[model samples]
Structures are given as structure tokens and as C-alpha cells.
Target: MPQTPHIAFIGAGNMAQAIIKGMLAAGYPPNKICASGRTQAKLDQLTADTGIHTSIDNLSLCDQADVIVLGVKPHMMGDLVKSIAPAIDPSKHLIVSVAAGILAGSIDSWLGQTTPIVRCMPNTPSLVGKGAAGLFATTGVSSAQKHTASTIMQSVGLALWVETEAHIDAVTAVSGSGPAYYFLMMEAMIAGAEELGLSNDVAQQLVLQTAVGAAQMAQESQQTPAQLRLAVTSPKGTTEQAIDTFNKGDFSQLCSQAMAAAHHRSKELANLYKA
Candidate 1:
């Protein structure tokens, strides 16, 4: 890997902490990172914890970092971008955003066209170093800048690029919010296990390991998920009985409907910014 350059985070929240931790763990020294937030106390805490420089002003962070990451909430993005626009210089800096529902074009428009911006959708699991992010960049973005952003994002987990903006919404619906859906399923499954007289510890460990192992197996296999399901279901086994119920319940249809709703809402959020 190339030497990790100085990067500044415009927010010192959980998501930013996750990125900072992952980068630090990957051998990026504390001096290469800077964190800025509304509160001095929060910035102070982050500085103490990570040894990175801390600031309350976005402009100050912008002046010092090679990459300036917008880490604030979606709705605050427009104003934040405008505020930091004066500090960005195309020759020396790259801007990357982690605000969901905010587009790269919008950031460029707010910052003046010379600055390159990248919009990314990353999830909460990044806090624990298990994150998946969807990234999209405009033509103005140089290859080196995209790779720099990718380096920061991939520190947590996987990243994929999409040609158009719409794919980021689909990513928000899937990997970004998908973890919550899995957690919900795990909760119910564990409850069902405990009801069958398994101890809480055993139930939790079994379900947790099952989810991890299943994900690993899926990644390593050439088979489709449907094919994997069939491989697990025997002629007269317990798995077959569960599959019969899931099929009867139209699991695929339900999943499609739920994901569609999430995608629609992401678009609505972007429109809200326009409004």
C-alpha cells in the first residue's frame, strides 16, 4: 500500500471513529488523521483516543488534509459543503462524503465545479471493522483520488463502485440497512431457540456462529443462494420443514417489497434536500 496521506474527518461521530480506528489498525499513524466536530469535548475525546489533530472548524481541517471527508448527517450536507467550499483546492485536495441521500454532484455544485467529490454509503458495522460501502464518483474525480477514497473505505471491509447515482440508493437499501434486517431475524431465531429450551447463551452463540459461517460459506461458494438452500434441505429433515414454511410465506416477495421501500425513501431524502 502507498503511504497513507493526511485525512481529515468533518465529524467526530461513530462512523468517523470507525474509519479512524480501522485506518489506525492498518498502520496509518495518528498524525495522519484529523477529526473535527461541533463540540470541543468530542474532538478532545477523539484526539485523546486516537492521537489525531482535532478541530471544531471544518475550514481548519480542510486546510490541513489531503482528503476531506464529510461525515455529518444527510440533511446538514448542503450547508456544510457550502461552508467548506472556500477551503477546497482541486490541485491539493479530494472531497469524500459519507452522508446518505447526498449526491456527489450536489457537493460539487455547492463547492464549485473544480473540486472533485465522492459520495459513499457505508453502514454501522464499520464501527467493528465489518463494513461494506458503495462509492460513486463523477468524471472530474481523478483515478488517484478515487483510489485514495477507496483505501479509506476498504479499511473496514469491501467496497464496490457504481456508474450511476441510482445504484447508491440500492446499496443504501441493501448492505447499508441490510444488517438491521439480519439482526431482526437473528433476534427472532434466538427467541425461538430459547423457547425450545436452549439456554440463552447457547441460543445466542449458535445463531451468531451460524450467521457468520453461513456468510463465509456463501462468499466462498459458486452456488446461488437458492441452490445453497436446496443443498441444506434434506428429503425429510427439520430444514425442509422450515423451508416449506418460508416458501409458503413468500419470503422473496416480502424481501423485495421491503428493499423497494428503502430505496424509495432514499430518493425521497435527496428530493427533500432539493425542496
Candidate 2:
């Protein structure tokens, strides 16, 4: 049997901790995982909580890991990659970056080698083990390395690969920023329910449960979301009335416009970071 790859996370922030915890919950060996961060206290706490190794030396962590997961902020990625570049063996180490808006090319350049790289755009939902992530791999990435990257992301939630690196921006628009859009809708629904004479507590409870139920139904049913909507919308029904209002308001078009804005912004941020 193949030995488990040793993975090292370059940062010990919330997202890193979430992934670490998720992997632990999924029965990944704690001894195989390690994390490095700026604060000793935080790293110590993480070690205490997960029984994984922790360090303050990034280069040493990279030396010990077969897969180096960059979990730092985008602005810090360049310096972090460069600092550990000398320690990395492109033939032996696979790079997986979770820093948003940092392109794979930029990471490759920073590493100063033709390293296998997987760029992942994972959302805040990963904190709760319900994230939807989009991954893109560079040309140098092997099939096995891609599987390793996917498995790590999957430990948290849904993980899908995009055809091209540019499609990562689309993923950013849809899933990376997707959670905020849903939260906005929930806020509107809760306010609307309260306006309709429901108490604040009741309105919030009902709106949240409704959102959860709808998502669960969509996941479990084979039917497309559009088909499910049609199934629920009877002629002259209350659902039809609400659907008509949304249509009249051009809700679908508005959603498209909003997502486009997000896509454009994602590109802008990437360019800014690359510059």
C-alpha cells in the first residue's frame, strides 16, 4: 500500500484550522498533518486541539511535507512562497494554494521552479464542513497530485475542478462569493416575513429553516432546480403569485448582473495581486 503523504499548512488561520479539523473528522491521520503560523500560542493551541505538528518555521515545514498547502493571505503569498522556494523539490513536492486572487502562474514564478500547483477557491462555508470549492491545476500537476488536492478540499465539502484557470474567476463569482448572496436573500426574506406581521424570532426561524429545506430538497431530488420550482407552482397558486413578482422584478437578470460584477472584481483583484 502507498504511504500517506505528509501535508503541511503554511498558515494556521481559521480556514487552515477548519480544513485540519475536517480532515481529522474524516479519519485522516493527525500525525501526517502539520501547520505553521506566526503566533506560537495559536500554533500550540492548534496542536493541542488536533494532535498535529505545529511550527513557526515555514521552510522547515516545507521540508517535512510532501504537499505544501499555502493558507496565508493573498498579499503574503509571494513572500511566503519565495521564502520556502529554496527548500521545495519540484519533483517531490506538490503546491496547493488556498489564497484567493493569487494565480497559479504567479505562484509558479514565485517558487522559481516548474512546480506542480493547484489553486483552490474555497469559501467561508468550509468553516462548517459545507463549503463548495473550485480547483484549477497547472500543466505540471500530475493526475495523482490533482487527486490529493481534491481529497483535501473534499474533506470540508463539495470540490469541483474547472476546465481552465480563468474559469476560477467564474467559480469565485458563483461559489466564493455565493454564500453572501444567499445571506442577502435570507435577510430580505426575514424582513419581508416580519413586515407581514410575524414576530422577529419566528420570521428568522422560518426563513432559515425554509432555506435549509429548499437546499436539501434540491440536493436529494434528481430534478433540476427549475423543474422543482415548476413542480411546486400550481396554476393560480400562492407560489405562482410570488414567482410572478420575482419575474416582473427581473430577478434572474439581476442575479446575472450581480454575478458578472463579482467575476469582474475577481479578475481585478487577481491582476492587482499579480502586479
Residue 15 alpha-carbon offset, candidate 2, angstroms: 1.0
Tens-digit per-residue lDDT, 179-268, candidate 2: 999999999999999999999999999999999999999999999999999999999999999999999999999999999999999999
lDDT of 1 by residue, 212-234 (tens): 99998889999987789889999
- Output the worst ten-in-a-row residue range by lDDT, candidate 1: 1-10
What TM-score against the true fold does each predicted structure earn? 0.94, 0.97
Which candidate number would show the highest lDDT if scored against the true structure? 2
Q: State residue 144's C-alpha deviation in candidate 2, in Å.
A: 1.5
Off by over 4 Å in 1: 1-4
